[model samples]
Target: MVTLKHDSHEHELNLTEVDAYMVGKGKCGVCEMQINEASSIYKCLREDCPNNSLSLFFFLHKSCAELPKQITHPHHPQHSLVLGREYNQEIVKLTRGSLPHLTACKLCSRQIDEQMWNYFCKACSYEFLLPTNAYLHIFTFSLCIRCAIMEPAIHHEGHKHHRLTLLRRQLSLICDACGITKENDFCYSCLPCQFWIHSSCAASPATIKLRFHQDDTLHLIYSVPHMYRSFTRHCQICKNEVLKDKWAYFCEDSGYFVHITCARTLLAYGENEIKHEAEEEEEDYAQPHPDLLQFPLPSTDSLVANLLAYHQLKNPSTITNPIAEEPVIQHWSHEHHPLVLSEKSTFKGDADSDDDENDDILICNGCTTPILNQHKYYQCIRCNYFLHISCANHLPIKFPAGKCLADPDHSLNLDKLEIKLGRNLSIAFCHSCHLPTNGFGYRCNSCSKLTDIICCLLPDKIKHDSHKHALVQHFNHPSFKMYQNICTACLAPVLDGFDYRCETCIDVQIHQHCAMLYPKSITHRFDSHTISLLYPPIYYKGIKYCEICELQVNPEAWLYWCRHCDQCFHPNCIRAWHNMKLGDKIFNGGIHRHKLTLVAIDKDRYPQRIHKSLACNQGHDNGSSLDVYLECAGCFFIL
Candidate 1:
């Protein structure tokens, strides 16, 4: 009797038995793929019979046909049969669709089925959605929910010590990573000189070329250990930590691997161009393999535009027309008050109080803030518009670095800046927002800072956070917009923008209006949570939050995180998104990576009511507030 060892994670099957053996011609009883039938093909007359109880049966020649079989169906207890071809073939044909178990093709990633005639294996009544999918089940595995109603046990051939049993008896198997359950069945053994195959074993196409590695296509082979020995958790295509192992995209060169479902195509349908300067790079002379590392380009249009723009913008010609001229300081009123333009040294009675009359004008045109000598400065001649050099430049700092980009027009070349003082240069950008300005900056001849015009207008009250009640406009308060102050949501300094604020609660205000993307479109993970459109459609019944993304939300927003697990999505997030019921499943392969399990509570919405829960990774400190560190400290700080 052949013992089975399919369930064990270890590969205990010996190398000698798995490879270099062959059997006589026979149709694959499962997928019906023809093998050894041609007269020209060689046949091996081995000792194993076609009807052996082993997961896969074989016959070297017809030696087993003469022997009497002593096998009885284990599950049936009464159905006994001889070891010849007639008895096994009759039993196999009679129980085709009745056999509740099936497996998938390891190569094409298809599933087994019995109900669909078109997909059913014609040779035996074994139904399978993908013909190639059926071939991989070289070792027997249980069929899906539809087929598992009848089979007693699932089996494998190479590993004869352990038995593999399906979880929940689903024809589709769950991948450990990302948790997607599907099928990829072939069980192969590469012995020494010749490869072994059960007469019932079907053939799968030996080569596949994925989109990413279109340049280097690959052929399927069992030579590499990492390719087939064990399951993997990381996505081979993206190098991200999420996916299954059975059905992998194999690189033919060294056999580097990837999960088939996660790998995406990176080929352009049309001719692609590369940016060139005075010369172009020579074409590579080495042969490109189909299964080599392939980086997928963005969509076709994006790739073209990116290539075109990259080349075009490589060298920008200097602007022909000069910027608008700076106005000479003459008669601009400070508020409603009649403020008069004066020389650099002029001040009220304070002029006499200062001993240094030659260069002691400490007044600033922006906010009229007084600056000390240590603050550093630039002085406009006509209006006596002096500025604190440090106050002239600022940047919108995001936590963890690199969320926003510096506007090309606004960012200045620090190497070009002079430190001392003078007006030889013309323009500069704002330090806080990096917007452009020219003429009256706090003139740093050393760093050439405040000699720009736009530095003449830094507003006081602004908003970048969400807590501000009324949209705070430029306030007359000169001391506003200082350090240790930021918008409530993003926590960035409120620059030139209207902010929601209250007089008593200036600390809280949300600016950065663009921060909120289309709120009307939301895809959540929970069935109990409902994402919805606020315009024409009103409130949903009991759903309060999204099921998948797990965001607690209001039902009547512009767009909301809809509660669903399978294929729910926000209209704006996806182009041409269709309205589907809560439990709708999508055939389009987008968002397949998300496990999207549904539950009332998740990490996204912990403590439903602010009660503390212990941290999974980092244990709790005494009275450690879970709410404080629930979300990542960076984004959470904004709210």
Candidate 2:
């Protein structure tokens, strides 16, 4: 194809005619449609063009009929180029394997057909012509995409306060148009003269127009009441179909900035680069062009084709799609849903549903799936997670809540148990872990675990990796307050809600434990016994040596008492005491604190007659609360 130099210094002329070889039939260089439809598609007469394909028009996806026909070429002397067909074949064969010989068009080269060319070669003194072959020689100004998309952009110029750019692009470029770096179509100027712009930059008017080119391209632009933007096809740069809502570009040359983007991206764009970046960034350049015309176009060939396709597809709602049902309030008519109660409610529905469809549907008491199965069913009002009697009976919910439910391991049904003390006096266990749960609660029938009424609202079958079996609340007794001093098994504090629980198997293990829990290794290197708790309140009587804290535990305060070793100790000191299992390694030294060793005492070594201090009454007095206050028992802190 006849091509132009990459230089921005040389202006491009859309040459009118050229010689081209008709190698074969192919898609139109301009429309991308096959040439058999030539009656409908116009052909560019430039030589070197690959059958009137898209590249000749800078890959414009629009119609060739709309393209401007007048243009100017920098290298050629032609001032008025007119559009026309190309050379005949007689001169083409002589230039094979060599550049074609052509003359500059009588009119501007920009107005020439892109697929044909008219040329001249001074060296060979030859002229090539392939007239009937309409698809070969492309226009001299036509550029390949590798060099087409770069845009006219400006930066501070030599004056440091100015900017300049060639209105035309020279080649591919780099910029953060969308903030993406690898490759993005953007506006930029050629490096030296810097005349460049992107399809996007060409679309954005304030960013698009340069002050330097304003005089040549725009007379004035401004907004009239509420009319800040204008969506004119001639000024728009972006290829997206959506029209701008508020902002609009105005140009005096074409009469509108709406086509500004279109004008700039146009290969033969007639304007130059804007001179000031700040001015280019400003929107108040020119006042509204008083003659604003809104043109209404009848649908065209492309629009009709796309619209027809869209209407042919089936609506999504009418099609079959998988439905995922979420859990909701459900109930069984029987014991299965022990807590399920029947109730009526409303529901939210999509627009298509009738007003009556807003009413609630029957749901299962357990899984909560819609249940058309039974006429009468129970529903859990709280969690919305309910089950049918068959399932609920199979699952069994706890009755009364009591201390047993408070245990983490065991569940309880306190309602079955008779209320012993008044509300404050009786400790009801939760149905979850079965430790006697305080306050009101419901328990799962199995697992002997206690659960608070609020906690019960959780989905059935809570699982803990720490527990071997997935736990459920015990449903046997409604309210049972078994122990108060300690959690029966662990002997830890019996806090608010715990389960006084038991596991079934002809054999079972239950231990009262503390509410303040730290993770316990179910398997301990210390013993075959899983570490168990001893309520410190009961274990620390008078003064007891704490296996953990090692200090004598106070008889009153709450502490972690271990049943494994059967000692009350500070919870924090368990590991410390464990570290000192050997009696030889006593932490508190008796040196100043008197390190006591069992040494043989020789009473004979003391003078039998020496009763000097013995003269001072030396005796033991058991009634005083003195600790070393009087080393001589004779005084025994009597005062």
Candidate 3:
């Protein structure tokens, strides 16, 4: 007796191998394809079941019966794909923007039928379309039966010089046909020429006719012609610069060029005609009226009026804020009087002020940072409300869809973080920084996600001194699943919050605060000279040890170094000792009855006592004692 688990069956089926003649003419339960009379099949042997009268017999082809319940495909190697037959439309719609390619088979670039049994990552589907407050790392994948069982080795027309062999190892390389670097566990490669191509790219048609170019049929070309290299060319579909050395679909008659991946995406979606119509309508609508274009005399008022009219027609709430239009504007924090922008310092005394000595300093209410006298600021005439010019300008009325990283699919409006918090929740945390804030920030009313002003102003791409390549900010990228969530700079595990990752170096990732906010140079108590932030590739003769931590410092990792003192220190060590003082009292009820005073154990004086008493159960010691310990103040007992 054998148990068979099938998608259509509610219970496990007792099955036995039988000829097609014994099961009669029927389709295979797995593939839903016709079964041949000569082929062997697995048939349900449960004849005593209560549902037997309803004729609920299961039949599967011998090959289909041998299919693994779960598989790890090359396209999505982050998670194992389980065979399933359910396709929820609501889940697909929510994740369409992030995982647009999931609608089709990742290998063949063909649309997947919702009714057919396919392989999918169950974990990704569950959390892929979660709200912005939750992590948004989703890379849903679906593979049809045909693509899953494709031949391991084949002679592709794209690379006719050699027969490409399938390599089932995760690799990041530029596909020869698409000219795009994609990380995949499976790719056909010609080892001799180091040529690699995606399965979809290799199977792409030799020629394709797009609705946008109905008059011309684009033929796949290995390289751009020398005649076409006379001038700069861009892909007609993507509008990106086309490399003359890479393979692309080219039309010599109309001189049209399209990227292989872009062509495949358009063909799979079949949106070329709809996109063409939309583009045509947009072009016609963009043309200004003849009456309005006839006159050249126009002031900035006309532009503002036109914008107001457009916003009123589209969304009246968007243009209701008059602060953007006026120089002296009423702010949400200080609504008593309109704040006026000024270049000079405003030293108006506060209501509780008793002295003029501290008037030189001014704090911006927006970020709670001291505003420099040299920079412009916005100030209120009657109150202490003040804001830096940069902060004042940074607060946009609303961020349109796809503009803000907090919620790419939805528009976020500028609102008080406190207002967005639910009644049960007392605090609101920024999606980017993960810091609780009550100040002004962007909020998505739909998801109730808030992003602080500081995070909202962060740029999409940043060139950090630690890495040679520019690090792009990712909200919750799927690639993070492949590597540990450890920041390379600080060497700390960042379980949550946004990160800036280098696309070229997949492992090179840093926390957003570590990349932008850390000080370049600092004065440590242990070192006399200023310790500057040191990048990788230190040409030291021997292994360098941190002066503070007394541990080996990795030369390839970023650290704080004092060139004058010839000392190195880990960034974490310096941060730990920044505000630390000896004899600090700590209240830990679990360890002691009273407050404990922080004290250092001198290795030279009490080496044996420290080794015997303070060592772990295994009695392991490094024989270096700059170690700090807590002493109970009440009994004077070392802890």
Candidate 4:
């Protein structure tokens, strides 16, 4: 029996049978890769196989064929899983379109390409989509490539009784194994003893190359029982107590013991030796029985690829001709047939009302927003698909040439989105704007992490409608007070990845999407008159206040200010107010005459309505009356 753990869950597997076999063209069932005819192969010979018991048995590479007797996977620690080589008929039958269940490559989060051969576990249906070039480190390591690469378990000499498993969350506790007090969010823990150790301590090497005493080799000491306690014992490096029952490196010949923490600092000092050893090793060959700590650290590119490969299906490539001719008939977001370019308006508009909806209701499917004013748009009559000229003209076929705010050093390229399966969701959302789309954007080359089209194309400086001077694109502010950076427009913490900072003004920062807000003017439900854009440095009375939110507005942030009434509104509040539909009701008010309904103010119909403030029974103790009252049609009272 073999147990494989995935997504913090355990799965049990059984190897029914094995035999020498051959398969042509298709990928191996165990590795999800093409098998070279010249290479040795094996097949499952079980009469009643778990994988559908199909007429044609599943095949595996010689390296992938070997199965362990009984295994306990970190993901599934409760029970052991047995490796099964049979092809799962249940998953194969759904090969017509897509599986009803959303399945991803267990090793990487990348969606399993439909109908492709993969290593599948019957218990969890956890699949592995392997790269054809991947080869085993050695037959000695029984774990699959995915499990081997991701958060692999470690056998430290300090905790010889159990293997310490790598965990992602922070555990604030004194390490039982090392007896060291450290503040790290990530650490390795022994599930059985609840013993935790810092990741750095877990990764400590077997031997330390000392700076002070080069002649002596400091070997790591694992067992430090309470019986070995002595008052005179002290770390040679830190001069601190080498606590009993704590592991440390000791040079017995030199009569010195160094704490594990002290030994880790020597890593930087011994970097030259580390590099020299790595250089001496054969490029393609590794030692058959290398020390647990001796494996070469993965490169930056490899680490990034490990993450990005989870979702990306296609091979990443640069876009040679970015400004290619717009397809006359094509698919932008929809995927039925090619959407033909047409000028006819497909939007159904209200005929009688001269409202803003009549003007801005025609939405572009690409940006998934209303087409403002006379911007030329393309529409498909049959499918009712539409696209803005700007989105259509600048549609990226692949990732674009731009610097990511996340990783500024590496130039990002665009790629088509490979939407994850099992999510009852449509449309790819931009991390910046939070809008749905099917356009191409920049992907981080190192990690394959994606950035939306709108964010990738932002200029270094933007001349926004609300600002007089251009707001510069900046990383986190050096003087940010909160743990997380905040956006000035919404007066909320900027939890999203990046922000646009106004260099001209102090502490003037907004999200990139907020800076690119369109429509210079808008009529908010909170106010009667149309609100105009106002940038930072909004000089006013003692303190400016926003009537919509009834909160104090930061004098140095962009606002939708009305000069006539001296009213101010946060940019986000204005957008939220504009998107609300009529007939909307609110439950809470100062005094409840009726639920506040969203109705147009008709001055002509309600001629006798007084402008004077009304005193409510629910008024505050200070005799404050409800201001700006409106008549509720249902209750026939001021609300």
Candidate 5:
């Protein structure tokens, strides 16, 4: 017999060592696990204790009875946590008011009863003097008895190369095994390779037999095979694009791929699924020939043969069949005259001159970009039209149905319009970038949506300087509906359009154009120094305001800042300055405007006028006046 003073109970527990079967069937009070027969257990001999009743008596496994009164957990190393029942009033106050669950273990994410034994950080509950809401940012760490004693390092079957160490704190990262981002949760990590996974994800079975794919078992793989990298594939269960670099379960025979998180739901029903055998050698998959043309070409035999002949001429070593004519192809943009291939400058007066002239900066009609002389381009001698060799060979005449995300039901034909001074400019904005352009684009006849060539060729995955991880393009997938639909760059709501989201960061979702088109650094007119884009958690002395708009800028959101000048500006403000060039005309019918020309004005010079305008604008009352406004170039009037 041993006398022990337990912190949870007032009476002294008289424990006696005996086999669990001798004490009859009972559960351990601390660990709450069944006391197996013949196992050594410390049975409480007290009969009148509150922890005992007529029907049941307090009992503990030998290990549970030997647990220490205090322990130093890795998650909260600052102070020693006390082992006790869930009777901390401070935790009850903090959790009852804000947290959705009554009491949850931070490690296992399981709900614990009030009478259950747990390890809690006592310092967190008594440190604050104010209302619980004010210090809600502080997390009260709590762990169940089972999780508190977990091993610090573990070896998972998924990653056989090295042992994974338990992380002390939760971080914003995606699990490499399951491809899911569970925010603010502890995970196992291999620091060298930056591999991370949830505790549950790390314990996933090596093989699973999904009900949908009954014929063959799906084997876990570290990554998609190299042969399947060229082809885009979606998850067999969720229908979302499967990340090629993340861990997934693959069926080699059927090419069926599923995310680990998506497949784990069916593992409970599948029996005899664990396969300890070595992974079979991957079979060689034949690589498909690369398609040069993204869209369909003209069905006419002559046009098709001419285009194929041009390809053959470009690569003589690859093509054996020879065409007996010069590759003069009829392009869709300039169908009136056949364009002849030219290696040298074709401008009438500058044919022999190698000097770079202003005419050398001729833009291609197909893509609306400058045409370089180094690369071979097809030019029309009868007209001033020119097409790059790549544009002529690959630019599709018309995108097939369901190709465009904006209007999937209809096909979009390639269209181009020249912007002239007198001609009425039908300004069409690219659906992807939302930037106005008169260049060549694919226009849907049914919806009249135009997508620029630059946006149409954007890859499925991109690396941006704003984020540390590669961003995957999403088209309003259901999996992302849990996150806030807002762009991290511009702080604007992401509507029904394409967005690039970082798989690691749960809050990082950027607009397609903002992710791809936004420049990292820009020279703003407001400041002489170059302004670079900045991420969240900006530390400044005072309230930060945009230099251009003179408005408070959210330091938590992305903004452009100049370190030399100690100035910041909103992304939209800088973009507005760049988009609106000097001498640009704006027509506002409400305001008296005979086409207002954009001009920079010094507010300091017209102090009296500003004072008078402010007084007049506020009906003879003192009020703040605008710092910047457009001045009419015609009559020198401020509008």
Candidate 6:
């Protein structure tokens, strides 16, 4: 019991020392809590005090009337937590931690904004902001409502049959809701069901609409047992096996299925990353479109099925070689006609070669390898196509299945020949690189109609220091109208062969090998600093001229641009002035009779037979300020 005077009157009151139950329930005025119990209390002897309302009395607990000098929190191992008030701006600095922006609450996984007053721990770097009064309830369960979702078990919309148990230790299990192997420290598991899900995957949405399969909506299937168990499932988008034990999406009516990660990938990338099916189907395919060079190659199975059936009906003979004894057969690359085996001793050079038969010189058209009189070869006399013995037997007819350099999403298949009266088109050229070849060719079902074999076999990724972005190989850009295919680098027609194109920038194309040939560093006589290759020379307000040749260099063309010297040299000029040594023999194209040897001119002693300067038929001037000229030894014709 205690007594105190209030309003000049003496009164008696009851008071007792605080206990655990009392400490837990007593309301405090300062912290506005029903718990904290460190500060002393006094009871008034009088029944009431001035400014009292609703029988309420002034009470203090811990630092209610005053302020907490410091506080120690388990979450913060280093710095002491301190109370902050409106007036004590200096003491207000003792917050738990700081959050620069609105971030997710660790307990609830809900977003918390920066406007709220926060407690900061400098040592542990913990940020504790009172999001709402509800967060205080977390102290009882030793977790958040979100964390409590995994306590004994949690029922997610993704998984309805059984509740998922919280897995606190590192899990070696793979997530059933997504096909990714789990290496995470924590996840949810159904031990009896042998199913696991990532905490992230558990938070996935119920339904999704993917770009690839836009016609239908997909419903999430939480476990393999919940999926269509009657048939083996494969992802339609990625064409990969969907494990029966994994989570995936399925459209019941359409039978469309996709991987969880693949769907997320499309959603994350948005429409730009999606391959437009409508755009690919927009081609006005000619009836009986047998022009193998056309965009979008004809179906391989149909063409090959017809060709093989026709070949079987036409020729059934099995010719076996007596020596080495391998079956001599007709190959698809050579018109499906019988190619008689010719041994090294029987090779009579090439019929078209100007060299005498005894000269022992020939070239195999297949590999472009020189065939000496001693090497065995295969030749089609009717077509004049020669191939090395090995090339004829083992050359690939189609590219392997994968996303080609030309089209990122489409899988490439070889172009199938349409046999017309026992012969396929021999003059066929690769639509991408315009190079004529009777070798393996490729086409993508997704984007391209046809592509050259050489271009399809190119490495999918290449690194070049001059290029800022990793240039991806594109077979043929559909954006270009017919006859409008142009290489921005050389400013020439790029109807054939693939271009290493920038995925980020449209209209940026580089020749595959040309881009790879850019030098990392180069020393020039005119420039003091070592210059490096620049894929695209920076275009100033005015046109940039090549420092070496003085010709206006196309900004898109590769240049050896020096940052220190601020000079740009065309790639051709770099090779001509820096790489080419004096006395190098080179051809001057159709205007010369023989190869010309490069020579420096003695300005005073000009040859009588040679003109001072001459221009080629194409109107390109031969005169250069740096190097003199190449002249014919026989006629002294200046080239």
Show model 6 residue runs off by greater than 4 Å: 1-152, 155-163, 168-172, 181-186, 203-206, 209-215, 222-241, 262-292, 295-639
The local distance difference test score of model 5 is: 0.58
Using lDDT as the measure, name the better of candidate 4 and candidate 5.
Answer: 5
State the lDDT of candidate 4 residue by residue for 305-404, as single tens digits.
Answer: 2222321323244243243335464544456666555444433445343332123244554443454333456666564556665455444445433455
- The C-alpha lDDT values of all candidates are 0.29, 0.30, 0.58, 0.47, 0.58, 0.46
Alpha-carbon RMSD, each predicted model: 25.0, 32.2, 26.7, 29.8, 22.1, 27.2
lDDT (Cα, tens digit) per residue for candidate 2, span 256-282: 333333333332332334323224434
How many clashing pairs does model 2 include? Answer: 211
Q: Which 10-residue window in model 3 sums to the lowest lDDT?
A: 292-301
- In candidate 3, what are the lDDT values of residues 1-639, reduced to their tens digit? 666676665656654545322322334566654334345566666666443433234567777777888988777779888876644444456656354465666655555555667787767754443666664444366777656765689997667889999875547888876778777435889999898987666765566554453445567787878755643456766656678877787766555677877776665442333143235456544444432211111211122233234334444444244445346767776666888886666444453544211222455655534444456678874555577654455345776776455457887787765422121213456776655554567777677677775565555565654555567877654345555665777656655567888787666788765665445676644667867887643435335677754667765457878989889887655543211123335665755578765554546434543645454333334465444456663564565
For model 3, state the Cα shift of residue 190 in Å.
Answer: 49
- Candidate 1's displacement at residue 273, Å, is 25
Please give the lDDT score at residue 630 for candidate 2.
Answer: 11
Residue-level lDDT for 582 in candidate 4? 27
Runs of candidate 1 with Cα error greater than 4 angstroms are: 1-72, 80-168, 171-174, 182-256, 260-639
TM-score of 6: 0.27
Q: Which stretches of candidate 4 lie over 4 Å from their true place?
A: 1-328, 332-335, 340-360, 381-384, 396-440, 444-446, 463-470, 477-485, 503-505, 522-530, 536-557, 561-570, 573-639
Best candidate, TM-score-wise?
5
C-alpha lDDT of candidate 1 relative to the true structure: 0.29
Q: Estimate each model's TM-score.
A: 0.22, 0.22, 0.32, 0.33, 0.34, 0.27
